[model samples]
Structures are given as C-alpha cells and as structure tokens.
Target chain A: MNFDMILAAAARLDGHARHTPLLSSPFLDQIAGRRVLIKPECLQHTGSFKFRGAWSAISALAPEVRDCGVIAFSSGNHAQGVALAAKAHGIPSVIVMPADAPALKIENTRALGAEVVLYDRATQDRDEIGESLAVERGLTLIKPFDNPFVIAGQGTIGLEIAADAADLGVTQAELLVCCGGGGLTSGIALACATRAPGLRVRPVEPEGFDDVARSLISGKIETNAALSGNICDAIITPHPGEITFPIMKSRCGPGLTVSEDQALQAMAQAFLRLKIVAEPGGAVALAAALYRGDALEGDTVIAVVSGGNVDPAMFTRALATL
Target chain B: MNFDMILAAAARLDGHARHTPLLSSPFLDQIAGRRVLIKPECLQHTGSFKFRGAWSAISALAPEVRDCGVIAFSSGNHAQGVALAAKAHGIPSVIVMPADAPALKIENTRALGAEVVLYDRATQDRDEIGESLAVERGLTLIKPFDNPFVIAGQGTIGLEIAADAADLGVTQAELLVCCGGGGLTSGIALACATRAPGLRVRPVEPEGFDDVARSLISGKIETNAALSGNICDAIITPHPGEITFPIMKSRCGPGLTVSEDQALQAMAQAFLRLKIVAEPGGAVALAAALYRGDALEGDTVIAVVSGGNVDPAMFTRALATL
Candidate 1:
C-alpha cells in the first residue's frame, strides 16, 4: 500500500526468497532492434514471481495467525508459490485449484506439501471452496494479486530493476510485465515511481484476454469475454483486481497485447536466446517487447517473464515453433 | 593457471560476462536426496560457460594480436562463445565446426559473427582446418580448453561457486562439473582448491565418453573408443587436454559418469524444476548429482549445468522423457 510497506516486505523476503537474475542476449536485442533486458522470475522458487508475494504476505502475518496456516485459490503458479512458502514457514497450506489446471502444477503443489482441493471451473466456485476452507480451518486466505502485501512483495522486483538499470547506465526504459490482475504491474509501477523515476511500468496481456489494457484505455475496470481458450493459462484473469486497478490507472503506463502465437514464439525465443524457460502466459511481455516495438518508447525495454510452470507438452509445442 | 589469473579474468569479465545465478529447487533436492544447488551457466552469454574462457582469452590477448582476430574449433557451445567474444572485441573469428553438430549451434555460431567452416567429424580434421585458417589469416588460435588463459577464464565459475556457497552457509560440498577436455572441471578444481578447500570439484562425463573418469581412475590419460555417438555431444572428447588433465588429476576429486538416459532426464528436470535449459552434455553433471549419489560425498552437492546449445529436436526428446 505504501513505500515503507514494500521495504518491510523486502526485509521479510531477505534470505527467504531468491534474488532472480536480469538476463539479456544479443539475439534478443537484434530481434527487438533495441536493448532488451529480461528479469526471469520464472527461475524463482515455485517457478514464478508469485513466491515473493506469497512469502511477503505469509512472513508479514503475526506469528499466531501464520501458525494457523494459509489458504489460496489459483490455477497454478500462485498455488505452488503459496504451497512452497507455507512449507518453508512450517505451516499447513490448503490450495483450491481448478480441476482443469495443468497436471504438473497440481502435482507440484502437492509435492511442495500443500493440501490441494480441486474444483470444476465451470460448475464449482474456487473462491467459495477457498473461503469455506479458510474459515473452517481458521487459515488466512492470501489473495493472489489484490492484497496490498502481495503487491508490496511483487514491488521488490521493481527495486531490483531500478538498481540493475542504474548499474547498466540505463536512465530510462519501459518495464514491461505480463498482466493478469494488474498486481505485478501496479506494484512495479509504485516501486519504480520513487526508486527509478525514469523507468515506466507497462502491462502486456494476451490478445483475447486484454482486460487490463481495455481498462487502462477506457478509464475503468474491464472484463474479458472468454479466457480458457488461450494457451497462456497462467495470466488469464477475467478482470483486474479492485485494489490493483486504481494503483495501475494512476501509476502505470498504457498497456499492450500480444497474440497467442507471439507468446509461444516468445517462449521459444526465451529458450533459444536466454536458455531460460518462459511459460506462455509469462512470455507475453517479451512477445510485446520483441514484436510491438513501434508501440513502445525508449532505446531499452525490460520485460518481466512472470512464470514458467509449463507442461512438457506445451513446452514441446513452443520448441516446435523454432 | 593459478588463482591470481582467475581473479584477473574475473576482473576483465566484471561487466562483459553475465554473473550467472546459482539456482535450486525443492523437487531437485528431493530427487537427489540432498541439498542440490545448480549453477546454471546455460544462462551465460552464448548459452554456456565457454564464454567466460573465450572472453578471458580474447581480452587478455595483446591488442595487436587480438586485432588480427581469433580462430577455434568447436561442436557448438565453444564456437558461439568465441564468436561472440571476438565480435565483442571488434575482431573477426573463424570457427571450424563438425557438419554433424546440432543445426541450432551452427546457425547460432554464424549469427554470432563468426565465419563457419564445416568439416566431417569422422574423415576431416578440425584442428588442421583451424590451424591453416589461423596461419593464413595471421589470426591467433584459441584452443577450446588447453590454454592457461582459457582455463583461468573458466575458473571464474569456481570463484562464484565458492562465494555463493559461503553466502548459503555451505562450508563443504561436492562441486560437480560437466567434463569435456577437462577444461571446466580442472579450472573449477584449481579454483576450489584455494578459495573453497572443502568444496572438492568432480568431473562428470557421459558413460561411453567417460575418458576423464577413466583417466582419473587409471592414473593416466585415457581416450574414448569412439569419437562420437552420444546425445551429450558437447562433452564427447577423445581425451583430456594435456594442460587440463594435470590440474584435474591433482586438484579434483574422483570422477563420475552418468548414462545418456540420466542426462536427458536431468535436462527435463532442469526445465520442469529449475526452469532453465540444459543441453544433454551440459546436464551430465546434474545427472551424476541426481543419479550417482552413491559415489558422491556430503549432504550438499553443487552441479554446474555447463551449456544449453541444444537443438529443438533434442530438447523435444528430453521433454518427451518427462
């Protein structure tokens, strides 16, 4: 919610979370026709940046509350992040996941020591399951992107980007992020606004699921028509979060969108150029950075690859594109 | 050749080379039944740790000699490393590559601004071609691993491992490195000898092409019966290098070998767990760490995923196994 809170979240995350790397490649630069730095949060614990927010939120909770455990509803990345963070904190976790979520994510969540409760996306309400479980078990429900602490946790990435940009002698750049609920985008925007004023945070979304983009342009929250068809399942929220939309509207730059094919291409390119995996939803920002260059500003663009909890079949499909 | 040279190489690489992250996963730790830390050099420039040695060799060269350009022979990763390093120095580079080498590696090498000279791995001699080209063009021939500067360059990885280990409070661990001509293994061994005395470097090679492992056991240089025929092409060397063998024999721990299946499994695990690409040869060290734990010592093991210049088909194959 505030600068000091983000600093406090970062303090809690110290030694507990990974300081993910900012990577670059000449091939990526050549493709974008500009300097492109990628912050691969996919390499973070649970293969996503969600772990930062998960840990931040869990660690910030009063010990008594934290000991009561945590609950979360996610399709994949957030579920695994919370699972791993809770396990690290020696607390039980209950994850309400869509039955259609990737099998790998489901298995990984369980493997990370979480009790997974699967629900039908079309019939059962994950929120209801999660809420009931949280109440019955006396567990704290950690919202994926709407909570202030999670945003503050994700904002730590902005602090790192600011420092790395300073080291690289970059005065200005577009900080692109794959947007689902605008939590990552808004969080980064807040962090960069004070830490690296020259760097601007921009949200990039899948073409059909560009709710955040539509909201930014229309000056109000927007919803997508459909989401399940897209391959980038990790970042397909129906709408931006209530708490996140206002912060993004005030602090972030205009949003951009990339097609599913472009997202797959970006995933393949992340493997080829950076040797790091980028799950389809995670690579939309990179796709936008590489293909939608005309819509972007500055000579440098920093894209945050949000997650890499990809199924092997999808990964094989991405590699097939090359 | 010594600790000072590695320190100097690290200095030269301060801004030029990527300080690759040492990554880990609870899944990987579970599989290995130990605390497994992975140094993903696959994220380094040119998708391999070869860039460190290449940059060190090229940068340390006399300006007049370096201006004449450099030549090298490689299957893939080293070619790209040298090509990129030479280009960074504003010098031309000539690469003699096996025609049978991965298509991705060949294309990447040429894309890195190197002139490619293809040769038959069975019938033609790459060294003769590289030598004639170097002599004809008054260029310096940068050996893949035999040179002192090259070894010193790769030694920087050991320095990083030592420092990161210290940060993680790991006083002792087996530092497993994927072996080829023993350059990477020996370089790391020499570095760990002084910087992390408790951290013993171990060379891990593919089963059939386990010349380094055989040599270590026999107490003499050993050669592979076949020059080719493994998925781990990056490390299919005929024998250990003259310079490298001595250092490896003296400073490194007992050698380890992993099967091709294990290597591919490790590659898949890297993608599934660590979200990083690791070519088959590059994953051999990780394979040993995961599968050959009986031969290893300590509660912790650090594996260096040496490269990621994998062809799409190979990557698909690795993914298929998962």
Candidate 2:
C-alpha cells in the first residue's frame, strides 16, 4: 500500500469526517505509567471509524457507479457508516444485516436513509446475497475491509493520531488497535509507519477469533470455525480479509489476544472512568492495554476506541457482568 | 461578568479542562424540527459542567489560598469536581458527601485525592460540618453554586458555544441548559447575554424542581419544599442558590419542565441516536426540547448535556422504565 494514496484520501476527506479529538487521560497515564492518548472514534459520525472508509470508497466511485448506488453486508458500525455516507453522497444504499443484529443499529441505518435487508446467518450467506443484489442492480459493492479505498479512508485516523501525538510532544509510542477483518489495524499501521516511523503498531484480537495473531505466527492466512463464541459480536470474524491481511502482515507489529472478561472489564472502565460508552469491540484495544501490562509497559500508547453502537440490553448485561 | 474574564478563563483552561465538543445531531434536529447542537459536558472531566467551574475557580485562586486548601459540600458532581480540581492544583481538599451517596461518586472523589467526610443528610447538617471543617482547617469554602467565581467559570461554556455556533453560521439560537442550583444556567445566561446578545437562554428543570422557573415568574428567590420524588439524582435540587437566582432571573429568558418519563425517553434517545451515554439529569435540556415542542419553535437550539455520572444500576433502571 502506498502512503501517498492514503494521504490523497485524507485530503479528499479533509472536512467530511470529523478530525476526532485525541483525548488525554491523566487516569490512563497513571495506569500505563506513560502518557496515554485515546483516539475516540466513538465520537466519529456513525459512531465508528467505518465512516472514513465508507465515505472514501463511496466518494471515489465513478458517477455511473454512484448513480447505481452501493451494497454492503455488515451487522454493526460499518452498516451505519455506509448508510450515512451513501446518504451524504445522494446515493441509494442497501445494508444486509444479520437477523439478530442490534435493533439500534438496524434502526439507525434505516434512519440514515438506507434500505435494510435482513438475512439469517445460519441459513443464508450475506456476501452471496449482497453480490447478487449488486450484479442485478448494477450497484457498486463496498466491502467493509477488503476495498483499497476503505483502507485508505480508515488510514486518516492514523494521520490524525500522528499529528496529535507530535503536538503533545510524543514522537514515538506504541499504538494498539482492535483487529477484526483488519481494516482499522492495517490502515492505522500504514499511517503510523509513514508518518511516525518510530511508532510501534500492535493489533489485538479477542481470544476466540485470534486469526490475525495466528496468521502472523504461522506466516500465512489462518482460519477459525468458531466465529461467534465468547467474543463480542463486532469483532467475531472467522478470518482476516485478503486485502487487509497483506497490509496487516507488512505493517502491523506482533498481534495480541485478550479474553472476553478483559474486554468487558475495559468496557466498564471506559464507561465509568471516561464517561463514554464504548461497545465491547471498541474496548478491546483498551482491554489489551489494561490487562496486557507487560506488552504495553513503558510505552506511550494510543488505544483506538473504535466504536460505541452498543445495544442497551447488551450494555446492561456487560455492566452486570463487570 | 466581563468578556475578557470569560476569555481569560477559557485561555487558562485551554488544556486543563476539556474543550468539550459541540456535537451536531441530525436525529435531534429532525425530532426537534430545528438544527440542534449538543454541548456534551457529559464528556467533560469529572463527568459534568462542574469540571469547568471547579477548574476555572481553582486555577484562579491566590497561591496562598490554594496552599491553605479548600472545602466543599456535595454528594454529586461538585464533590468530584472540587476534589479533582484541588488535586490538579496540588491543594488539599475536603468533601462532605451523604453517607448513602452513589458508590461511584464517593470512590471517584477519593480517587482524585480528596478527603471524604460522610454525613447523614436526613439527620445531620452538612453545611454545619462543611463550615466547621473550613474554620478548623483554615481552608477556603468553595461553595458549589453561591459563588461568583464558580458562575464565571461556568460561563466559559457559554463563551465556547457562542463561538462554535458563530463558526457554524448560527447568529441566534435558543440555549437550553439544565437548571440545578442554577450555576450552569446562570453562567451561560450571563455569557450569552454579554457575548451573543441575540441568543435566547432557556433553563430547564425537572418537574419537581421548578424553583428557577417559579423564581423567574415571581421575581424573587422562591423556595420549594424538599420533596421526595422520582427525579434524577444529580439535578434534584430543592431550590436555586442566592447568588445564581438573581443572574438567572435577569438574564435567563424562560424556564421549562419535563416529566420524569420525558427525561428517561430523552436519555434513551441520546443513547440510540447520539451514541452518547446521558444520565437523566444530563438529558433534561434535550428532554425539554424534544417534549416541549411548542415552547421551542422556529429556532436553532443548543442543549447543554451537563453530566453523565448516573450509577450503572440507576441507568439500567431508567432505561427499563422507559
């Protein structure tokens, strides 16, 4: 991946996506024993970094393709991101959500002027359905992680973080991000590598779906059958995407795995201490930072709180468990 | 009261207190039938607008007075605010909290390095204890609302909103601020009246705590009996303070009240649409805008979400009730 492409995407999205604040927490600093910065993507439009990718991808489409609109298969943040971005570009968007996806996400996507299509994950393949719709309607398909425009779009977060870190007198630091399809981790790694060459990028995954870590260990693509075990719904992917895997392999540092309990604890901590509600998936990087003390030791680390589109029921249950 | 004083406070708190973002919500705008800007003090340090006041007040204290320490009485945001502000300034601070205060608030105040002295609200006089502590320890009493410094500090939020609104092409707007002891509402009113004279400042109160509104109508400090009710804990004030009443009466335009149900509904809406966790008290102004439709017509409005420190149990219960 060329850094220039990501920089061009950032330039195109200059005033579109929010330059989300690089929030500093003295409490987090005390815990890490080093300066800690939080890139609050939870504050981003559609409550995730997915908006960056969706906007970049949709905006870069040809006029004819844009006229035909776009289709995406996501059950959470990416769904809302595409819905909102497509609306902003005056394009029709259809989001294929799992039958049991959070009601808030479904409602929010529809509210953002997207057509909501529900599918039972156990009985039907969402990707096949999305592709069929795309072909039948002559619409563009915006993959959540595999698209280059998406990666370049999410890379803008890293640019913001690098600029902020420099402003805060932090030239070098450890950056922790949650890995699912690896879009955010890879994008952030590429940006950090080019902008702050000395910065170390660590990608963390939940224990049950540690494909990225396993793939790194085995030096190839890895797969897992247990996609929806104890891991949070947003990060419970079976494997990394083909497009994202190469970026993760080349740019990301060693990957780490955190337990479900740790992620829940981190979610509670974010809510209680930071007074911000971070969905379970969004809190994984923070969980790794807090529980994986040895890995983060003596490093000025940045934890990407990727999103906050948590279901109220799930939030209450997590709070109870915590 | 001076524009320069507010500007100076803003400058002093440039990095000390969060320059909390003015979040725009199309969902809120559609529901309220006007452009809605949310000043998320829920994202502020110590989880409330109290942080701004406490930080500004403490930062401007004479060096000798700061060294002598400070005392405050509260079982809510102010207690945490004073504790954190004092800790930030390296000054010893004492807080008088009710014995049955939320465990989170008590823990947070102690965590911020304040000495917590528990008092029984039903049987003991908190003011007596606070005054005694101030006299015995030779500490300055940092009154939560009945202080000019605190009001001036709180005014900085208004200054920020005015500047942000102007940048957003808003010349005049209705500012809905939740009224507790009226420190925040009064401060905002003063700042808006001075800086953005065309701005309309509206104070919102919970149904049972309409002292500010009543005082506005009666043209005097109207006292209300301390009645037990199903109101949010943070803004369940019995009456407005002496210092804040006059400013609110003179500068504030009108006051409105919403039912507990409305507050709960608004809180849920904030969670679902804005993706921000807003405690019932913090959601009151937005509740007024959402429910008091005819009262807030034909104007762009800014609602100040003053805090987000609700106990997890209370938050769940509030949502369940809704």
Candidate 3:
C-alpha cells in the first residue's frame, strides 16, 4: 500500500485517464443533509472506472509481454476496459465473457477491436478458459482485480477526489465507494489514506453480497450465497478477491450495505435530480449514503459513481421500480 | 440581431452557464465519416439547453421585474428551466404545463420550488392562461423562445463551441443544431456569424416539422399539420416562432431533416459510443450528421446535443428499436 506507487501510476496515466467532472448538486445536498459531491466515472472511457486500471496495467507491461497481448475474464465493464486498453497499446487481447452477459457489452468489447469468447458460466469455467488461453498463446492474463497495478490505477480516482475535495474547501470527510471484488475500495482507500489521511473510506455493498463487510467485522475472509435477482448486475453478487480483501480490511473504513430498493431509489434520484444517467452499480454508493442517514450525519460525503454502462432496458426497469 | 447584446448575454453567463464539455468521439467519427464533436447540453441544469435561455432571460430582468417573479408555459424542459432560474433569483414563479406532460418532469418542476398550474392543451389556450397568470400576479412572462433575452442566452452555447473548436484546431466548419421554435439555431447562427463567419450553421428539423426550412425558402411564415409519433416530444412538433424564423432564414445554413428512425439510432449511438444520454431532440443534429453523410461533407462539424431529459421508458423504447 505505497501511496508513492499510486502517485507514480497517476503520472504514467496523466493523459490517458479522463479527469471526469466532479459534479455537485444543490438538490442532492439538500436531500442528503450534508454537502455532497459526485465523481462521475460513468463518463470514463469504456464507460467505467475499470479503464483506468486496465490502461495502467496494459501500459506497464514489458514490451515483449505487450506484444504477446493479454487475456481477461469479465462479464461487462472490465471486459470493455481491457479490450480498449489492449487496442490502445496495439496488443491483441481476448476477453472471456459469460454467455448470459448483456449483448451491448459484448458488442462494445468487439467494437473496441478485441476478440470475445463466450463461456457458459453454469457449464464451463471462465477462469480456466482464460488461463488456458493465456498460457497456450504466451499472453499475459490481466486480472480485473487482485493486481497491484490495477489497484494503483484505481487509486488515481482517490487522488482526483482528494484534490477536488481540497478545492471545494472540504478538509475531511467520508468517501463511499461501491465494492465488488474490493479492488476499487482497496485502491481508493490506499490513495485517500496517503493524500487525505483524515478522510474515512467506506466500502458500500449490496445487502445480499456483503462478504467484504462481514469479512471486515470478523477479521477473516467470508463467503456469501451468490445473490441473484439484484438489479445492479455490476456489483451485486461478487465475492471479494483474495488479494484485495486483506488490503480493503486493513486500510478501508467501515463497510456498509443497502437493499436493492434503496439502490433503485438512489439511481432514480440521480437521474431526476442530477440529470445524469448512472447505472445501478454506479448508484450503490449513493444508495448507502441515503440508506445510512444517521451514520453519514455531520460528514461532507463524496460518492464514487463508479460507472454508467447500464443497458437502456435495465435503466428503465430500475426507474420503474423506483 | 445585435451582436453586442448577444455578447453581453454571453458575458453575463460566462461562469453561470455550465460550459458543458465538448466531447469528441472516435467511435462516432469512424461511423459518421467525419469527426463529431458533441456539445452535451443534456447535462445542463434542468436537463436541457433551455436552462441557458431561462437563466439569461430571468437574469436580464430589471430589479423591479425580478421582484415581480416570472411565468411561462411549457410541455417540459422550458417549464423546469424557468422554475429553476426563478428559484436561483429568489423569485416566486408559476409554470403552466399541459395536463398530459410527463409525470417525472411535472414533479421535477414542482420539486424545483415552482408553482405548477396544469392546463388542458386540447381545449384551453396555454399562452392565454400564462398571460393571465402573469397579468394577475404582476409576473413577467418568459417566452420559451421568441424573446431577445432568451435567444441571447441560448447563444452562449455557440460562444462556448467557438472557444472549444479553437482549442481542437477546428475552424471553418458546419454547425448542426436541432431546431424547434428555432431559438437555439437563430442564436447559434447569429453568434457564429459574428464570432466565426466562415462557419456554416445548419438548422436540423425532424422530418415532420420542417417549418423553418420551408419558411426560409418561401420567405414567409408557413404552417404544417404537426406530425404524429415523434420520439422527441420536446421539439419534434413545434412550429418555428415568429421572432426566430427571420434570423434563422438570414443566418442559418441549409436546413436539414432526419427521420424518426434516424433520431432513435442517433440516440442509441450517443449512449453506446459517447456514453452520454441524449434525448431524441438533443440527438437530432447528430442524427443529421450521421445519417445525412453526403450533405455534411467538408471541414470538421459540430452538433449541438440540445438536451438529455428523455423519459426512461422512451429511452428504453428507443434503444429497443435500435
């Protein structure tokens, strides 16, 4: 958890990563009972924050490794991120996606000039296929999470938040970020600890998949039933990665969880009040803030709106539920 | 039109306007056969470019008039814009909206702290109601388009585009802007005429509402049976306003028309490629550039994405169609 490495990674990605707008909403501030700021990573290239880590990881590879290309297994955003990053580096990459993945994401991965291989999640193993492909082709497997470079890349967001908070006259505050495999939270916590040491970094997760929160409380890795039927397909059902859970537990602030309904409400609020389209996963952090009203009291909060690549159909359905 | 007045309005809105990001899309560029620069006004306050005009119009009022408050009739965005602008000035306001207006928009307008008066568009005259409301309350009526202040306010976007274009090394280009009552096109054309004379300013209309183009050719106001089933509820059906027609005729480049299918495709492309949510009307100009390839040849072209307030249902339907 060296902050200098994160800063160095930020320097390497100076022009590559978008300095996404830090959007402020007077309406959200009024509702949240505190000053609130939103970091819109949904507007990032490839429509997610994953691009930062993917680009950083791809760019950091040795010339020979880069030439040999890369492989990764992801259901959505990370697939697009890796695909686009590999294309940018002139590396031929193959992404193994679940057969049930959204068609738009599959098309986007292909559109970014990457090879897509679909694997049945129920009948076949995605990781095994990815590993075999990487090994056979002498290609590097870029893990979506659990990679130090990936963590450093995601930390760039924390750097931006720290600088932006300072500019907004915010000295200390709580930072809420959605958690999947804990990469985003772990990376962001590391950066916040280094840049704004007093700032609290909280990982917000879906109620059904609160493994990270449970793990944090027990001081050990925990598993939860693989949750389904959650509208936020992006972060609803993932277990914390082995490498990321420890870092997240050691460096991150208290973990929180919110129901699916709360996430829907937050997503709707974002659409109606902020006039920005945020995917369900993107709204989870805000959901936690809205749900944990008393917990967030007296704290100026920043919510990481992690991505905005929601399918139009899913977005409308989520809004209807709200 | 007085360029000085427009420039003054621009100056007044210097920091007030969002100075929305002019996003370049390599994906769209590859598809459209030309570089595409999108001015994302959908991300503007009130979810439309109407915010600029509304704010400018409200801000330009004399202190006495400001004290009196403001009134307006709109089906959607303009209502919210006036409501928000009046709130910013600490003036009470009333918005007269059709009874059948979108529920989200009506609620949003009221939430912005405006008094919303519902009227029957089929049986009663909205303008008459608005005028009476204004007269009875001593409130100023902020016309949706047909006003000098409003046009100048909308012109600020053109100023922003000019500055952005200079940074991108783009000069002498086609500027395609969506046209409803022609306020945005007239204002943008006037601004470009003064600021970048070589720029060709084209007003794009829905296939069903080519009134501005027809009027420009005939040298007189013309009316047509409003088309049915336009996806862009905000602008697809409005006839050109009297004040805007002359300016549009004199300053605008050749007006262009795009089909409903084309508009939906454009919206889809914007969401998929640029990761921005654009309402149908907001994407009409971009649709013209993308679908009317032969018509928009030459130097770099910019399309004004007028707004991003599509109903979630409409967006889903549009995406499904695409």
- By TM-score, the candidates rank as 1, 2, 3
| Most TM-score-accurate candidate | 1
Worst 10 residues of 1 chain A by lDDT: A97-106
Error of 1 at B76 (Å): 1.3
Assess the local accuracy of residue B51 in candidate 3 as a C-alpha lDDT between 0 and 100.
84
Best-fitting candidate, scored by lDDT = 1
Q: Which tens-of-lDDT digit does each residue in A223-295 have in candidate 2? A: 9768666647787777888988988888776888888888888777777667677888888898887778777
Better of 2 and 3 by lDDT: 2
Residue-by-residue lDDT tens digits, candidate 2, B241-298: 8888888877885789988888988887777666677888888998988778788855
Q: RMSD, model 2, all Cα superposed?
A: 2.6
Per-model TM-score versus the true fold: 0.96, 0.93, 0.87
Error of 1 at A138 (Å): 2.4
Tens-place lDDT digits, model 3, residues A49-71: 99999988888888998899999
lDDT of 3 by residue, B1-322 (tens): 5677689887777656666767765678877888887888887877789989998999898999898999988767888889888898899989888899878778888988899999987999977898888889899989989999999999988887887787767877889999888889989888888788767899888886787778878888777577556776678545788888888878886788898888889988877666677888888999998888888867578998898787777667667865
Give the lowest summed-lDDT range of ten residues in model 2 chain B.
Answer: B224-233
Residue B108 in model 3: lDDT: 80
User: What are the Cα lDDT values of the candidates?
Assistant: 0.90, 0.83, 0.82
In candidate 1, the residue pairs with backbone N, CA or C atoms under 3 Å apart (3 or more residues apart, or in different chains) clash, namely none
Residue pairs in candidate 3 whose N, alpha carbon or C atoms collide under 3 angstroms: B42-B308
Clashing pairs in 2: none
